[model samples]
Target: NQRVLVTLNGHPLRRGLLPRADGSRYLLFGQLVCRRLGLRVGDTLRVTLAPDPNPDQVDLPEELAEGLEAWPEAAAGFARLTPGRQRGIAYRVDSAKRAETRLQRAMQELEQLARMG
Candidate 1:
């Protein structure tokens, strides 16, 4: 396993390299940061520690905001989730390229959390 310092969402995140169940290099970041970054198993990622990669603020784009608004029920349900879960959803959505895909993922996560709840 290789050791490296990495930055995630503007914060310094130190993690260890470990083999995944499928025998790939996996990063073992803290649970909180992992949720905050919205990374999932087998997700490809890049990290640079020294130069912080500051993500923009959490204001959803106009179109995405409209989409989220269209699902008031989902948004309210999401609001009831723990801050960690909320951050997880936000992080995942922010990582998407297309607004539609982001909305879909956010909705999917909301459904999963709802089922768990």
Candidate 2:
């Protein structure tokens, strides 16, 4: 996987390479990225790419791990989610600095996932 710092019309942001559904590889300049930079489709862009030294696929928070351990149905549901969704959940849980907050968020999201399945 590669991590790149992309400059879109002089605005900079970092993003990683993603694997496409058809087994192709691509980089995404998402709507938020474009919006933040006041960019539109067909706008010129400057890109620079390099290998990420400490690239992490997804950093699963301990609280989320424990939540999965405690809820088998939630765990099964979570397992069936797309990698992007799984990674998003992990990132949200990990973003919380406090242990209790992380745990609460983990349980909330996981329970919702379970109910949806």
Q: Estimate each model's TM-score.
A: 0.37, 0.52
Question: Lowest-scoring 10 consecutive residues by lDDT in candidate 2?
Answer: 50-59
For residues 6-71, what per-residue lDDT tens digits would candidate 1 score against the true structure? 675555654445677888876656554566679777777776743223332243434445645776
- Per-residue lDDT over 1-117 for candidate 2, one digit per residue giving the tens place of the 0 to 100 score: 466555555665556788888987778775645665677877777776656554544446788888788888888888888766787898688667577888889989988878865
Error of 1 at 31 (Å): 17
Q: Which stretches of candidate 2 lie over 4 Å from their true place?
A: 1-15, 18-57
Candidate that would win on TM-score? 2
Q: What is the lDDT of residue 55 in candidate 1?
A: 33
Q: For each candidate in turn, give its C-alpha RMSD to the true structure in angstroms.
A: 10.0, 7.8
